[model samples]
Every structure is written in C-alpha cells, then in structure tokens.
Target: MDDPVSAQRASSVRRSLASIVLGFELIVVFLATLVIFGLSDLPAWVTLGGGALLCLIMVGTLGLLRYNWAYGVGWAVQVVMVATGFLNPAMFFVGALFAGMWTYCMITGSRIDRQNK
Candidate 1:
C-alpha cells in the first residue's frame, strides 16, 4: 500500500523544484524581452507585445504545473525560448542554459520522488 504521507512529500518536492525553475525562467524571459526591444530593429510592438505575451504564458504555466500536462507546456516554452535565437543569437545560449536547468530539475526531482516512494 502507498503511504499517503510519502506520496504527498514526493509531490511537494517535485512541485517545488518545478516551481523554482519556472520562477527563474519568468525573470530571464522578461529580461530577454528587454534585450530584444533594445537591440533588435524589429517593430517595438512586436518585441514588447510578444515578450509580454510570453511572460504571461510563463506565469500561467507556473500555476498550472500541478497538472502533468503542464510539463508539456513547459517543454514547449523551452523550445520557444531557444527559438528566440533567430531574433537574437545570444538568446540561443541563454535559452539552452535554462533548458539544461529545467531538464536537470525535472530529472532530479523525479528521481527524488521515486526514492521517496
């Protein structure tokens, strides 16, 4: 039989790790928006508007992390982040760094959960 307390602890650990990654990613995405705004010749509305929309989505995703499907959304966000490289090459490196962190957190968190179980 599963121990309710252990299950809850595992869930909490996973959620906490995921939350941390998303929270930091929120800030990074916001800063990347500013970089795009200042550096790119693209229309201001496109950069600012797109950045705002992505930031909003990231925030929403953070809240949705409790659901398994949300992790897929998170992965999509990472891909978008990396794709930003087309706009600013620097973002490719930055995005990859965050993606690595995200991957690490997901894998490590799951390992911890399994151990707890």
Candidate 2:
C-alpha cells in the first residue's frame, strides 16, 4: 500500500519537471520561429502565423500537464518541433536536443516518482 501524501508529492515532482521542460521548449520554439522567418523565403504570414500557433499550443499544454493525456500531446508537440526542420535545417538538431531533454526529464521523473512511492 502507498501513502497518499507520498504519492501526491511524487506526482507534484513529476509534473514540475515536465513543466520545466515545456517552458524551456516554449522559448526555443519561439526563437526558432524567428530564425525561420529571417532565413527562409516563406511568406511572413506563414512563418509568423505558424510560430504564433505553436507558441499558443505550448502555453495551452502547460496548463494541461496535470492530465496524463497531455503528455501524449507533449510528444506530438515534440514531433512538430522536429518537423520545423523543413523550414530551417538547424531546427533538426535543436529539436532533437530538446526532445532528448524531454525524454530525460520523463524518465528521471518517473524513476523518482516510483522511488517515492
């Protein structure tokens, strides 16, 4: 049997780690958008609009982190971030780097949560 307080604490810790990753990713995605706008010949609206949309999604996801399904959405966001490589090849590396970070946080957080439980 598990203690409710410990379980809740573990959950809080995991959520905090996940939130940190997403928050940092939000900044990187925003900067990547600027880079894409400057380096690519795509129309201003396309770049700006797409960037704005992604940013909005990130912000929204941040609020949804308490839900398990939100983590799946986070993974989808990671895929989209990597897809941005089509607009700027550099984003492939950057996106992968962030994905690695996200993976690390998820794995580490889970381990910590389990240990706490």
Candidate 3:
C-alpha cells in the first residue's frame, strides 16, 4: 500500500491511524480505570467512563496480533458493562456496537492478507 491516490501516503496513513488509535485507547483505558477506582464517588460517571474506555480499546484490538490482548480486555469489560447496562438502557450503545463490528471486520480482512501472502 503506497498511497490512497499515490499508494505510499495511503499505507502510511493507515498504519499511522492504527498506531495512534490503539495508543490513545490504551491510555484512555488506563486513565478511566484509575479514575473510576480512585474517585469511587461518581459511580454513574465512572462506570460510563470505564465503558467508553473499553470501547476504545476494543476498537484498537481488531485483527492485529499485537493488539489481541487489548481486544480481549476491551471486549471482556465491554461485555460485562453492556450486559449490566440493560437494566438502565439510557446510554447509546453505538460505541460498543462499532467496536464489535470492527473486530468482525478486521477478522474478515485477515483472509485477504492470508490469500495475498
């Protein structure tokens, strides 16, 4: 992959986006986990933050072996949160859904890589 229009630029952008997004998600997960545990006062907000962070990590996990651990953590936490949230049903689940779909899409994409190789 060179560039979208050129080949090089497109490949660079794709790789950069993966690294940047995964890095940010890891940071967010750590920060949110700390905030939720340390604060302990804002249960609603803290849980929501944790859920959000997990969602981000899940996004980072899709199909990259290096990110597989992140995907496991993110998806695990997200599933627990999402299952529990059914009682309240107030927040939008778009993030969680996207994360799941992204994982599926990434897994599907791996076939292309395998065939190419």
lDDT of 3 at 57: 49
Write the residue-wise lDDT of candidate 1 on 1-117 in tens digits. 999865684466677888898899899989989999999999999999999999998899888877878889888999999999999999899889989988998898888878876
Model 3 scores worst on lDDT over the 10 consecutive residues at: 86-95
After superposition, the stretches of candidate 1 with alpha carbons farther than 4 Å from their true spots are 1-11
Tens-place lDDT digits, model 2, residues 4-80: 86569546766888899999999998898888899899999999899999999999989988788888888889999
Give the root-mean-square deviation of each candidate in angstroms.
3.2, 3.4, 8.0
Report residue 45 deviation for candidate 1 (angstroms): 1.2
**What are the lDDT figures for the candidates, one per model?**
0.88, 0.87, 0.48
Tens-digit lDDT track of model 3 for 14-37: 334444545554554555455555
Q: How far out, in Å, is residue 97 in model 2?
A: 0.4
Count of backbone clashes, every candidate in sequence: 0, 0, 5
Q: How many angstroms is residue 102 displaced in model 3 relative to the true structure, after the best TM-score fit? A: 2.8
Selected candidate, larger lDDT, 1 vs 3: 1
